[model samples]
Target: MSKYFKKADLILFIIILALSVLGFILLRKPASDNAQIEISIGGEVTEVHNLDTDAEYIIETEHGYNTIQVKSGQVRVISADCPNKDCLNFGAISKEGQIILCLPHKLAVRIIGGEEGLDAVSY
Candidate 1:
């Protein structure tokens, strides 16, 4: 405790830090085992695949082409004919809500969480 930071200040700081950590633990979305990948072209959803499957897809748009791969519960853009090649740098995404976008080809790959099935209360 210093002139500026008294015991009260230290207690308040510790309380705030504890609350922050608790909030993150309670609010963060957990990775879902039943996640799936959704592919979109020109803003329209084109395909949906299960994360448990391994596959590759070559999407050809009017502007160019992009090669995407899904392997071992993760999906990424492997190659593309786009001029910038920025999409390839986005790397792989496995968690729900993660997305990889190829602007030049109007292609987007996104991971979505589990299906909305009937819960215990609904039965």
Candidate 2:
């Protein structure tokens, strides 16, 4: 029984070490530098003249209102008229699958990136 236990422990340690090394390798890889597109629910598309300027756009929906800001090379929600203010607290999300939801406004903000052109992002 003791021999079997020792072998099992060794196997577990080897597996853990392998996983740690794999994780480190993955973490060392460079991140993707893709341009992000901003979409607003029930809002019209407008061109921002000044790329260096920081501006906020207000979006009003049936549920509530939200303030979106464009800064640096990204866009994010700065504030919202929701009760919990959770949407505003989300700060910014640049990766795929990351989303900002304002239940009051029935609004959702997401990042979409790919090789092909985006046809549309559905709820």
**Strongest candidate by lDDT:** 1
CA RMSD of each candidate after superposition: 6.2, 9.1
- Candidate 2, lDDT over the whole model: 0.61
lDDT of 1 by residue, 19-111 (tens): 988876664454477777898998899988888789998888789889889999878899999999989999988777677999888888888
Clash statistics: count for each candidate: 0, 0
- Please give the distance, in angstroms, between residue 2's alpha carbon in candidate 1 and its true position after superposition: 20
List model 2 lDDT by residue over 1-123, tens digit each.
474578778899899999988876653332234434445554543322222345677877677778877676445788777898988878865554455777666667655444343335432
The TM-scores, one per candidate, come to 0.70, 0.51
The regions of model 2 sitting more than 4 angstroms off are 1-34, 38-55, 114-123
- In candidate 1, list every pair of residues with a backbone clash: none
